[model samples]
Target: MIRARQLKDWLPITKKEIEMRGWNEVDVIIVSGDAYVDHPSYGTAVIGRIIESEGFKVAIIPQPNWKDDLRDFKKFGRPKYFFGVTAGCMDSMVNHYTANKRLRSNDSYTPGGEAGFRPDYATVVYTKILKELYPDVPVLIGGIEASLRRVTHYDYWQDKLLPTILEDAPADLLVYGMGEQPLRDILKAVKSGVPLSEIREVRQVAYMAPHVPESPDWNTVELASHEDCLNDKLKYAANFKIVEVESNKWQANRIIQKVGQRTLVINPPYKIMTEEEMDASFDLPYTRMPHPKYSKRGPIPSYEMIKFSINMHRGCFGGCSFCTISAHQGKFIASRSEQSILKEVDELVAHPEFKGYISDLGGPSANMYRMKGKDESICNRCQAPSCIHPVICSNLDTSHKPLTEIYRKVDAHPGVKKAFVGSGIRYDLLVDDFNKNNQDGNHDEYMEQLVTRHVSGRLKVAPEHTSDATLRVMRKPSFKYFHKFKEKYDKIQEKHSLKQPLIPYFISSHPGCEEADMAHLAAETKDMGFRLEQVQDFTPTPMTVAEVIYYTGVHPYTLQPVKTAKSPEEKQVQNRYFFWYKPEVRNWIRNRLTKLGEKDLANKLVGNTYSHSGNTPKQHKKNKSKRR
Candidate 1:
């Protein structure tokens, strides 16, 4: 690891830093909505470092003052190639507001966790400023905000469908997904004297043109135009299904959409990165900390949270409907080699702030490391969005031995006391009932290893919802599988005499979920002795099945109507079910359930009966039955 001991080590964030590097002009000046953190986890740092690795002078203007006289956009002057803009690691709207559409007071990506560091639509704001200042200079947009919004989709915060970000941002080019492969290709082409607008054939890129460009190499799929989607919501829903399937394919078709008179062409993404390539990306010269400029302001909450953690992989195959992992990272699991992961572990242990503990050795889904199709040819032709949903794909190799081996190797590090899997696990993969492919008992071995060694106090898993109908819409397994997994988990804990609790995450007000379902979830979980602490109200974001349903009132896959709680009152009623244990909400729950004619469930959840031991009603009943 190349530690940053001086300002010169980091990529130039100011004009003086550029002068310090003896550069009159940079090849690329990246404008980001996040504070400068030279960590591998941060997208701005990754993109900046990648540009530097390619022997280009790159500087980042992070969290530039949009309200000011636009000094930050002009700090490094116009780049030789183009300006790369991103709304940081998160989509700006999601970062700025809660699910309830309330303005958030803390920005985790900002120094001191203060709000108002960046505008609402940060990428659009930054790109517009750059374009206004230098109309001749080309602008490139990427990162989560751009990648997910590359096509016309729903914007929950705005409560309306917005066209491709290109329509508003007016960037010359957009690099979607992880951006490394596309960025490299674009840079090399620019170095070869090709203009950004002329470099059209690169994979994982989107651009606007008067008409669709013909490519013999890739078959093209024209989506419903933005105007058509606006006129017909079902057409919009159908468009989403196409976008989702194409996004997950190993060999995908180039996507074309009509935004207006101009056509938006989105070339297919690059294939899954090889182990060596994945290693190279993670093995970049990152300082693994925020820039020194923020030393007095206060620590960035997001950076601090992942400072000591090691990401083992890049993608998830679970493909939960509500998640954006597959949408941005793709469904294929591109995992680092063991050497790369262990090297990161070594760096983490050596960091000054590390306390002999590694915060996480995980990715989008912790247990999905190094998993893929058993048949390469099968994966190439498959278009299914999820690998282990509905039923675990017969072609999938669900072995846990590789991950277990890596965990053991990580534990063997002399300086490391514990390396926890902080990322949420796909718990269904562990249940033998759900995953029958674990013939060698590797799941048991891995579970024992994780519970015995990795967990700090609790391990988090997302069952998502309890109702089967809701789980189906969410692309999750039934709650019965959760019960089976919990039983096995309890057995393992009992056998080891360990007390670590299993924290299951759930969502309220999701599409297909009703107040009654939430009540049942409350009663069932209360019976399981859990007052759920990790619950969330479903917030529809762009390019997800749930979000599409929320806007269109129909399942994108089935094109059938599905009820979603949209009103604040409906959402609040669904949410209150999760807090039935609170004395203040018990009466409210009783009244609501009584109105729903679910008096039995209401009594099960917030009954008048109480015990001195403070056990739940069901548990108290069990104790009474034992006495009898």
Candidate 2:
């Protein structure tokens, strides 16, 4: 443990000073400047836990009701060690999703559009506060927000992932990749009298300034001289191929360098931590919650929300072209035992506000549980996250038994009125079951049991798009199949005398999606009647093929070119499904429907006046004219 008086001033302290604090002593205090909490965006929480596991006392401070004053952060007690800081999840929302994704939460809350989007997020104010206070606190910034926007990229708001975040957060060390392993290595090295500058050579830690003086031509990059810097602005900033140094470090790139003194992007080819490591990390005491501060809130984790999330499994075998779950989670599954889930459930139920309902129970695909590789050895390393919305990889066990049984046990509890499966279940997996096609099919029998007996009324399913071409791109089940399942579900509900619906979600502007594709989806929804929640203008997330396509307009997998949706008018048209009923929107929809031969939809919209419009451009213009 490194002990010091100030930020970046943790010089070689006496062994007595280090020993003065027991193994449980906190040499540093970590401040997590996060915007919100959810599973997957748990970068800060994991870091805090790992540091604690290493015998360092760590406190995580929540900035939800956060004041923009740095003085507010002084409550966690002064650190005799170091402070870690981040730009929070909104930075990720800006970097990974379209800038509009940040607008999503605000949109969700605000009924008239503003109500339901990112709220309480004052990045500018928060960052300015950080800048003013603790100017010398050796701050560290990381997470998707910082990683993706560490340098300039295509930021939608500013129209690019400009150097804005770095400029604002002002981190001393910009740790990227999976930060846990890198952080420990960094802290240890610094404790060993290594300067932060010397620690820059470590893999996964992206530091400022170039390591090498010049760029090595890719073809000429030698293995021993593996560290080459890039000079080109875009490529330089993106030199993150520092793979884990495995038995075979040369697994992916033979040479990872280009022009410009960019930096040696470490894509460590090392095999990720084994299954035991993964299990140990995830299987930690579920009872442990990183106390944001040693204090009490009025009430915690509302019935509608959960404080921390426990991942049910690792890896998604489903290889959807546009998804990165496979890239991040891997292409295999390592599910936790039913017993573990029960333990988590017990903890949740024990929460003083236990209302017998968990906000959600899920993994990559809520349905995939206990999937493993053929060999136990490979399974440990095969922590791949399967894509749930589209294709279910052949390797993945699409068995619903384990999950259904687990759900039944969870739902059967007297206190729990509802157990929602928030993660989208794979629709294709359902088709494989007998119930997908036959109302009297065995699969249908299971469906009846699950839906009537186990499932909450609104079971969420992601049929990303309706058009076959679009489905093909999403690698998802087609419109024909989704409808078949819905029909079966409807019949099963009728038979069971239950009221439940397979509420399907759709995404617009996924890589291959187009105006015509969206038109097809609109038609499908019209026929289905007041059904289908749509995700408009899919923004590419980090390491996702879909995002690559969204950026390059070229299919990452097939190298094929696709027609992209860029026009504001096009986005607004498709968005009408989410915000349907704008008269101008209605006119646009009617015109679109008329063009697509969806005459009934066109007629219905223009005739009945669905009346969901808020303030349309036409309305705004008209109001302006009246004022004039």
Candidate 3:
């Protein structure tokens, strides 16, 4: 392992850095919406490092000034191969705005957590600037914004169905999903004297074509036209079902869709990375620090949060309807070898800033490391979006032994004082009694180890909602599983004589969740003695099942109509339930419940006579009618 001090600095971000590297011109220039951070967690850094590993000269122009004379885009001039543009680690709109459509005051990706570093629709804006400045240079767009908005889909901010982003951004190619493999192929093809226009056969890439030509070798599924989706909501809902299913499959068919006169063909993504490949990607020589240019601007909040953390794996199998991890990272889990993880731990120990405490040793889901299908052939042919939702698939291997062992090994390091799993844990995976077939009776062992060692007074898990109906719509398991897991967790804490808290996360204003449902959730959790602090009003981002339901009024999978809180008043009403314990919201909650003729729930939530001390009366009036 490379010692932290011996690691090379960040990639060239300016002409001086390029000259320092003894290169007059670069082969590829990456324009990003985020401030340049040379950590593996940053997408631009990873892509740049991968290209550099291929012996290609690469440089980044991060969060460039697009409002000026377009000098930033011209600083790097034209690349020998292509100009790679990304809206950074997050979707630009999500980074810029809140769920309530209010402009966010801070961007975590920017240096010093400043706002307005990148413009709205950053991918489109950057690509347009590069194309206009260097029209002859081919531009390839990737990252979350381009990946999620590759095809015609709903745009919640605009409140309409917009066509493929390619229609708006004049780019030659769109590399979607985790882009290491496809990018390597694209680079190889470019090195072989192949034009960008003719490199359409690469996987995980989408390109605009003059016409829809027949492919005799590959099977294709054509989606509803952009015009049809724009004209009809039902057609739009149906199109998302195909897009989602194709995206999750192991061997997906090539998808073709038309937006106006152009035909957009999105090839299937590369298969899940092997253990060696995942290790190699993480093992790349990353300085793991923000660029020195931002030293005077104060530390990046996001970087500080995870500087000492280790990402054990990629992707999620939970496939929660409201989440987009599966949409971009794929449902299959790609984990690093034990050696790779330990090497990173050693590197962290050597860092001058690290104080022997590792912030996180987890990924999308903490306990899903080294977990996958029991049979390779079964997984290859499987089209299920989630391996552990609704019910854990019988073919899935949900053992926690591997993860527990890794934790113990990391803790055994003399240089490390503690290693926490900061990512949200899928509690259902620990319910061995509940999921008998998939588990190996090691649930208690894993739970005890985690609560006794890793947790720092609190462990977070997402139950999402209390209502079974809403959980189904969210593609989450029943709340009963949370109760079961909580029982086990409490038992383990008592055994260890520990006082750790099991913090459950929930979402308000989710699809299929009514105002009454939110009230029920509040009452149920209150009975369990929880004043929820980790709750959010559902944000409808692109390429999520809940977003599709929110925009189209129908579930993509079942064409069944779903009710969503769209209006500001409607969403506010749902959000109020999350704060039922607050004195200010108690009266409003009672009034809304009384109007809905749920007097029993009203009294249960806030006593007939509410108090201002943030506490409900000990004795409450009983209702004549039985509870619904």
Candidate 4:
């Protein structure tokens, strides 16, 4: 049977079980979900790769068809340890994430429905199947998806931060933070015959049944801590979210989750990769072949049509409130040499289907390449996760020389018509690239080319929100600066005769956003004629700044977020900001506007609403606000 036959994609060991525990030919199987849509890259792929590198036998089950019977995995036999690593989903959970946000939920299935065949369920399903196949194997679960789901997180669809996935999904142990070093330690400990009970004390790992309690035995806070009694406890509870773990500047290791609460609070383990380790990890002999695993499947657009992924660096320096890149990838931006990028582009140009378009090249922020703290040793001593910025750390490097050269070389390549940057460009950094006046001539020139020539239709940017008050809460772009950027882009488009438009990406229903806040945004949109087609509602993925806002109604770090109505009705109002006409919203907007004493603006809003024609959801949300 196909199930019984040897597996091709994942690095599975023998398909037959070994006789005894020690005699078991294998010690563990690291189960990882591929962030590499095409496989052989990203998330678990890297974790598994690193494991195999350590001389341990690790079989990476790339992307399993979650709908299939969990029993099929029994064919691969069992390992002394089973490690579950996911990029973002287990069973159908990954597929459920809406790529195209337009589709609304029908009655058949709900977006926040926790009990179905999700990753956690699939973890259990597979665990049980493994048990039936080989009784004593241990399954360890961890990854961002599981890490966040470790405890209750804010569920946008349900309008609350819910509880840990562990209670529901039967995982034996959980690796809470970045699992690299932690998993390595786990494999070593397990293969050496460490008992499960004894393994509980390891930092960064939260097991289901602990051999010993972390706190004093008498410190038990009841099975259903104050959380279970809340009217919406199941909806807004946190399982394992870690805030700042220590007073130390070892940022990654310091910012952590509260133990066993089902939150994703811990950061990746290391603060810096030794020069040699960084060189070895990135400078591997990577050939530009279709990732070996996916090549076996026929070519597809996401794989073949794209050129080099061109990772210029590894970490991020920005702590944009809405993003996890810096927290997850860490803030240390390790860049590749200029020669490396030039070679990759040459290869891209040589590809048979090479159009003049060189595709995209980016990493973290794409700008902070080979940057270090001003005083590396001292900066390491200062434990704040992000540099307070503008004050200057001794270790941080704000210079863009290395990055600029790479950009120049790629653009100069023979077959390259344009080199796009899919990675985000930190505009705030750009604002500072010049001589303290928010204008840098050379920075402007290169950035203009990158945005206008490269971004195919529009340069996408996330300003998150436009209110000065909200920006502070979000720890990001100032409304004043973003407005200036809109003006700058307009002038640039006119000056360069570029066809690209500014694709400003916005989010609706973030923790601090209110109906009035959205209304204010709509008014700004009307004034700017900014017809935004893309709107993202917040998804409080476990262990994020956003989740903390939903839970305590306070920033877990700072204890402040403007109270906004988080109800569905309030969200619907915000969703309509881009639209100009909808009768229900129109009426509500007019009434609300009149009460706010903006009679003249209300009339103008009505006029604008009437001028727009369509009655789609977007349209209604708009007109309703204008009229109100």
Query: Which portions of model 1 miss their true places by more than 4 Å?
Result: 1-4, 609-628
Model 3 ranges with Cα > 4 A deviation: 1-8, 610-628
Candidate 3 lDDT over 355-411, as tens digits, reads 889989899998899988889899889888889877888888888888888999999
lDDT of 4 by residue, 1-628 (tens): 0122222334442343222223445545644443233222245555655566667765545444456665435545565556454534222343345422333332111122212323433444444555555556666776655654554455443445455555555556777545565666776776687854357545555544432244421122222332541453332223222332231235334222322444322223444544445444444333333344444544434344344556666766555555555545555665666666576666557656667675567776766777777666676556554542333343455666566667777777777888777766666655652124323354566566666666767777777777666666666656666666667777778887877777677777777776566667767766777776766766554455665575557665554444754555666667776454555466566666678776565665544343234354567787789999
Could you arrange the candidates by lDDT from highest to lowest?
Answer: 1, 3, 4, 2
Residue pairs with backbone atoms closer than 3 Å in model 3 (clashes): none
Clash count of each predicted structure: 0, 54, 0, 52
TM-score of each: 0.96, 0.70, 0.96, 0.74
TM-score of 3: 0.96
- Candidate 3 lDDT for residue 477: 88
User: What is the C-alpha lDDT profile of model 2 across 29-74, one tens digit per residue?
Assistant: 5444442222232555566656666656665444423443354455
Candidate 3 C-alpha error for residue 278, in Å: 0.7
Against the unseen true structure, what C-alpha lDDT does each candidate score?
0.91, 0.51, 0.89, 0.53
- lDDT score, candidate 4: 0.53
